[model samples]
Target chain A: MNSITTPSYAVHFNQIAYTELNKHLSQSKYSKIFILVDENTHNYCLPTFLAQINEDYDFEIIEIEEGEVNKNIHTCTQVWEVLSELDADRKSAMINLGGGVVTDLGGFVASCFKRGIDFINVPTTLLSMVDASVGGKTGVDLGPLKNQIGVINQPQMVLIVPEFLKTLNERQLQSGFAEMLKHGLIRDAAYWESLKAVLDFENIADFIYTSVTIKNEVVLQDPTEQNLRKILNYGHTLGHAIESYFLESPKHDLLLHGEAISIGMILEGYLSFKLTGLPESELNDIKASFLARYKKTTFTKTDIDTILTLLKFDKKNSHGNVNFVLLKNIGECAIDIKVPEDLLKEAFEFYAE
Target chain B: MNSITTPSYAVHFNQIAYTELNKHLSQSKYSKIFILVDENTHNYCLPTFLAQINEDYDFEIIEIEEGEVNKNIHTCTQVWEVLSELDADRKSAMINLGGGVVTDLGGFVASCFKRGIDFINVPTTLLSMVDASVGGKTGVDLGPLKNQIGVINQPQMVLIVPEFLKTLNERQLQSGFAEMLKHGLIRDAAYWESLKAVLDFENIADFIYTSVTIKNEVVLQDPTEQNLRKILNYGHTLGHAIESYFLESPKHDLLLHGEAISIGMILEGYLSFKLTGLPESELNDIKASFLARYKKTTFTKTDIDTILTLLKFDKKNSHGNVNFVLLKNIGECAIDIKVPEDLLKEAFEFYAE
Candidate 1:
């Protein structure tokens, strides 16, 4: 594919990404380069990424422990202190070479270190490539809440090398596939229909490219999430709460982000049928498509109640009201739709069915 | 005298500030209004500020401890939690009603909360009114390093009510005055001469206005502190190191920001005379002026050595070189000037004189 242009930066793919990154590095006189990574990326992805650098440059690998649990302010504090200890000055550049947790936290670290510094995002996960690659939303989870403490800071460039997808487990691939499915659901019916079939892991690059293009177009219009950008949070309203609930609960098996959100899309699809005139047939299609791949987990009444309460803390909430983005149709989304609690319970029941 | 318009927001003065604030409050449909204060502002300033709120609105008072000690990410976390607990959504507006500590930290909190939110700076301290009001440099110090973590986020407006000056003690007032003096030294020599006379606290409002104007003009050109803005740090390089050293050292008496920077101006002035064509006569004049107001603190050889080491950590530093903004003349400034360690030692000796 070709390079994707954002409002401020570019998203380069495969060989082009390496070329652009090298060109950029040569032109910008960074005093030093700090590559942020997680333990997983350090072992699996870092060697390949480091090999792509064409020049003999000063590089520091600052690795954090992997996973969503590590993505918090404490981690940020440690990284910042490390940067300071390592003499990472204002002129130094940082390259975030991991998944969403690494990119988001690393971008925030770079943006905030000495007011702001230049950083590049080398997303190593399918999830990060499809979702985090386009948006300037860089932040860390606040306690159990997801992405609560963060800022909208764009990277200098984003490099999406699809070969890294091979590093991800089947669960991780499926998790990323959720966001790609979200792109189709929110804006492209034809794409949504195409995604209903089995995800072709062999041809994943094309899917990643399309997903990024969809996200890029939306964010380019509303980078700040003022209005149009809220559409991107289609399933995220309930999805995040579900993710947070499962993340916090010791009893439940950790659901991959995609698995939880897959359930969110089904519940939200049901809400759309009742509230926004989404056809019952389309909603069923949405449910069947996700259910075919993701295992259906039973939510106890307490779980349902807790998740509903958690909705109030959603970043999308305003005026003490939990807002949802429901599909008017598969290709179209209606933002800021205040879904009633009783109807939400009904949507959950629909998910169970 | 008149509203100083920034690139994005306006700085409303005294009575006009209240009017603009009230007008703004009435116009924007904020979910809630959060007033961030410290213990001092809560006791001294909030009563008067609350009275100015002509209309009854949902208000939450989020107080952090007063002083620079409390300005850190830990305090930010507390405030962020409180904002979340208080349901401070994206539509909610925050009014930062304290000194530089409150305004800088609160602006950072409001900006990073839920990505970003609208905030107003109600600068109660002269330091905040003149320096923190216009720059859009919102941050908290990391360990002893000042402003190590933050972003350049502008407020919706800045309200400078000089009456708030009455709430500050002599030390607080003096601390703010140092920054005002900085404005004159960096940009307006005549203003510097005028400020050398004993500060008439009754007429302090005029000084604040002029200082803000000088700062506003500079920030309007380069809000990001890329190049020209470094001149604002004319005295801050050594000043910050001196402040940090005192702040962290248990043996030393706590120096007000102004007191430390006052010394910094004298030392840097000597360096300027030696390295940047600043007249020795003017350098002596700068030292004499500060000595007349501020008591000379003894910095032992160890203290001097530690402060010099801290210079490497300054935000202005890039490419492993500690950069300084020196005075070319009384009103003129030179940026990115490199000073050697031997000359720096000599400059400290000049201060001892």
Candidate 2:
């Protein structure tokens, strides 16, 4: 167990069990309700998933063309016009039954419609249920930038039954699992050690539950991501750069979020070992554990250099310093730690081969 | 005193001295605050106003071309982009010091930028301080339609400093004063009588305070205009139709809000007389009092006919039967009362000569 007790929610993550869903969907008068889904969830996740929902509602499913590239103000305005034509009154609610992009976009639409209405989150992705749902942040990307325009408003509640994870390919599942692992590594060493035995889909449920608990506690401490919440950005600092770098490249689908973060953690662990004098054993253990689980993708010196350049544009660099969250130990984190140019170059070489 | 209680806020008018404004201005943290004015206020009202507000704020004045014709999505967006580039942050507060249109549009634009920021209302026109600011119903009209898209958020607090009425032209002051009289005719008889003596700017400060108090109480009872609040829509049933019709005409300056509503009250009061056998004396008192105070405009048969045609679009007309708020006496109101088409035409002709 970790000694760090920070304020956060006690988020529960499980399969979207039928009996579990039926319990909460009692009908009320609605002007008109809508379910927003993205292309992926529309095909892969929504059909059997909606069958599990208990009651009937006067609602239609609104689907947008898939992918993060479509998450912009134009898409949001289209959704708003549709809702307006549908005669969505104050009594209406939107069920965002997809991943983070769907919920984030849906929540933004609902917040600005006739000056805001209600929305419920049904996060289908592992990254979404544990992280996005617990935070009240909702927004859309501006042009090519990330989350440039948004608002902070909490959902009525988030339904985190995680059975939707079944449809995800192995790569997708592993991508999500990386965030779960980082939660344990940054907050609870015992939980980190406990995870060594079970890192695959077969045991993703219990691990998801524990990871959510750790994240909820972090959020409860600082919901705004002001101070301690920066710790959650540990692997994400570099992980996002790597994800952004690979997203524009020819190697896009070879990895998902968890896969990218797993790589980020490996390189960051190497950085930890080199600069912080983290015990060599712990460093190797973290690397070998992720290597054993996540499928490795090869990147050249140029890819790392491109990623390093992109890191400077990160949204969190408010004061223009590239800050990293480095692990002092398995259960400890120190933020705003900058690494040297040569050290970063050397860490990327650890995976170059 | 009229036997009817003033319904919580029906005390007669009273002035708030310049010292009161100085005291209230000291409480806000703003280093430099601004008073937004239009061509009308700039020419007719600013000299006395600037003299009074001296030393309270490092005030900056901005003027826009006035009139309801200027209220459009383009203006709102322009105002937003300007406010954003001006470096107005969370700490800065805008004092919307104007009539209904300025308060409505200014409050709406300020509410949406940077997601939202704080603002206060110092309503110069009676229509705003009494109804718009008190209920926090801030939004601009979309195109020719009224508040077709908007939000409901409260101002920091509405300062009911009515001395600003002193500079309003006789017609402009009466344009606002008509709504105050409607408040009494619909909700408080004592208030209606109180206005008979104090409708002029000489006694308007006290009356403005009472009008604000009455409106503030009614709004608090039902802030969203969901149920109990709809009672406040007494004269507004046909009033808005007459207002909208006049708005589209080249002769808009010939008809202000009070003139349209005075005509509406007379017409709607005639409907009450028809339905409830409200004494002819009360009906005549309604016509005589509005005529006694207002320079009643002569509406031709075609003008009256067009206004009646437009009444069908009033938001309160749920099934399009033209629901009316009728006065049983000076203070008593009956909601959801429907009037016959022929009777409405007859009421319009009641003052045709």
- For TM-score, the strongest prediction is 1
For B117-154, candidate 2 gives per-residue lDDT tens digits of 56766677766656675666666543334454455666
Per model, the share of native interface contacts recovered reads: 0.86, 0.11
Candidate 2 per-residue C-alpha lDDT over A107-140 given as tens digits, one digit per residue, 9 for 90 to 100: 8777756556778778888778766766677876
Q: In candidate 2 chain A, where is summed lDDT lowest over 10 consecutive residues?
A: A1-10
**What does DockQ give for each predicted structure?**
0.89, 0.13
- Residue A119 shift from truth in candidate 2, angstroms: 2.9
lDDT of 2: 0.69
User: What TM-scores do the predictions have?
Assistant: 0.99, 0.69
Going through the candidates in order, state the TM-score of chain A alone for each one.
0.99, 0.87
Per-residue lDDT of model 1, residues A1-353, tens digit only: 89999979999999999999999999998999999999999999999988988999999999999999999999999999999988889889999999999999999999899989999999998899999998899999888889888899889999999999989888888889999899999999998888777556777788789999999999989877878898888888899999999999999999888888999999999999999999999998999899888889999999999999899999888899888899999899998788888999999999998
TM-score of 1: 0.99
State the lDDT of candidate 1 residue by residue for B1-353, as single tens digits. 89999989999998999999999999998999999999999999999999988999989999999889989999999999999888888899999999889999999998889889999999998888888899888999999888999999999999999998888788778888888888889999999999988456777878888888999889888877777888999888999999999999999989988898999999999989999999988888888888887899998999999999998998888898988899989999999899999999999998897
Complex DockQ, candidate 2: 0.13
Model 1 has a clash total of 0
